[model samples]
Target: MALPFLPAEHIPSMFDELDEHGDNDRLDAVMAYVFSIWINRSVFSMECWSIFMKGVRTKNECE
Candidate 1:
């Protein structure tokens, strides 16, 4: 499956929030949030694909 795409709006702010020391707490929080969402979507997509494939196989077996 393809990787999950994050929302475009979050991209700019994440870059803007970064500092030379890379010590921005808010950026870390935002990144964590976005990462969690991406992970969830990827897993959900895989599960859906598995279900669809299972249905296809069952239908083919019955034919």
Candidate 2:
């Protein structure tokens, strides 16, 4: 499916930005300071948060 606001060309830039910081493990911390490429960032906020949450989720169940 196509992204709601971002163009295909900008996707690479996103990955590049993420990669610049380090590995996927640091994505959550990096995401907190990210804001670009997408024209309507607010619309993508949930998606970003979703990615961050998924990466940080632990095997232990929530108590």
Q: Highest TM-score among the candidates is held by which one?
A: 1
Model 1: residue 23 alpha-carbon error in angstroms: 2.0
Per-model tally of clashing residue pairs:
0, 0
Query: Which residue pairs show collisions in model 1?
Result: none
Q: How does residue 17 of candidate 1 score in lDDT?
A: 53
lDDT (CA) per prediction: 0.44, 0.47
Best by lDDT: 2
Clashes of 1: 0
lDDT of 2 by residue, 1-63 (tens): 133234444554665565577757567555544535342365655345333223335776562
The TM-scores, one per candidate, come to 0.29, 0.26
lDDT score of residue 62 within candidate 2? 69
Off by over 4 Å in 2: 1-5, 23-63
Candidate 1's TM-score reads 0.29
